[model samples]
Target: MQATNQSASAKPLSIRINRVLYGAFVLLSLYFFLNGSYQDAASNLGLALIFDPFNQMVRWENRPRWQRAWLLVHLLVMAGIGLVYWKTFSA
Candidate 1:
């Protein structure tokens, strides 16, 4: 138990806060999307991106193909969601 506590406390405060916010934003985005609020989902997703959830800390050229693909797919999906929201509500 003491080891676990020490490990938990080892992380910097900002990183902990970021992890919590990242989770919250991702869940919020999902909630909004499921309830037919595409605009809200897209906006929340954009906010989540600011937290860099994909974590490209590794050098881009050295990263595995799947990592690159996942990030690319995520960005594409975000763009798709924004386009959908725009089309649905635009005048």
Candidate 2:
């Protein structure tokens, strides 16, 4: 009975909520970026990374192909955006 209760209260629902929150952060980031709010966009991007919607905690070699690609692309995009913003505004 205790095991059943713990299992019933476990992560499935929280995982779903995290995914939703992650998506919202990404969308909000995009919105800020497009609207010329670089600081807010970058902030949201950091928040999204904290949420780690893609669950990239697994070892690099242990992660499947799509997971690796997702995390890599995310980091690359963030870097690219930061570079562009810095170059454009930090003269």
Candidate 3:
């Protein structure tokens, strides 16, 4: 019984930890972007996507259609920035 209670409590704690890590990744991506580290920014964004493709923190799926479209546009812009940086610097 004690073990069952402990396991049940652990589930929410694990989810919270995952959300916190996801938030950190998003913040780090922004930091990299601001500092002109496009490659790293893109990498962090990729990690975030892997962790939370639907953008749960932002409740992206619950938002209206236009907002969802804007989120896609934002991701594309980030990808473009990284691509341009790679092309310019990878000679």
Candidate 4:
């Protein structure tokens, strides 16, 4: 019984940690986006989506059809930006 209680308590703590990390990733993504670092922003956003803090942000089931499709759109846009940058700047 004591072990069960400890396990239950630990679950919420882990969830809270995940939420904090997800929030940090989301903020980092926004910062990168504002600075025109599309690749980094997309990477961080993808991480946040994968971590899925609280299941409240970036969840496919919680979103409308268009919003769910936006994930792929976002990735494609970022890839295009990266390709442009590489072609323009790479040796």
Name the lDDT of candidate 4.
0.74
Top candidate, metric lDDT: 2
Task: Show model 3 residue runs off by greater than 4 Å.
Answer: 53-91
RMSD, candidate 1, Å = 6.5
32-79: candidate 3 lDDT, tens digit per residue? 999999778877866764444343445756777985874575578667
Candidate 3 overall Cα lDDT vs. reference? 0.73
Q: C-alpha displacement of 84 in model 2, angstroms?
A: 10
For each candidate, what is the lDDT? 0.75, 0.78, 0.73, 0.74
Best to worst by TM-score, what's the order? 2, 4, 1, 3
Assess candidate 2 and give its TM-score to the true structure: 0.62
Q: Model 2, range 1-91, lDDT digits (tens) per residue?
A: 9999887677666677788988999899999999999778877876776566654446789888987787676687678777878999999
Better structure of 3 and 4 per lDDT:
4
TM-score of 1: 0.57
TM-score of 3: 0.53
Q: After superposition, how far is residue 81 of candidate 3 from its true place, in Å?
A: 11
Candidate 4 backbone clash number: 0
Per-residue lDDT of model 1, residues 1-91, tens digit only: 9999886676555576777887898899999999999778877876776665444446878888987785676577678877887888995
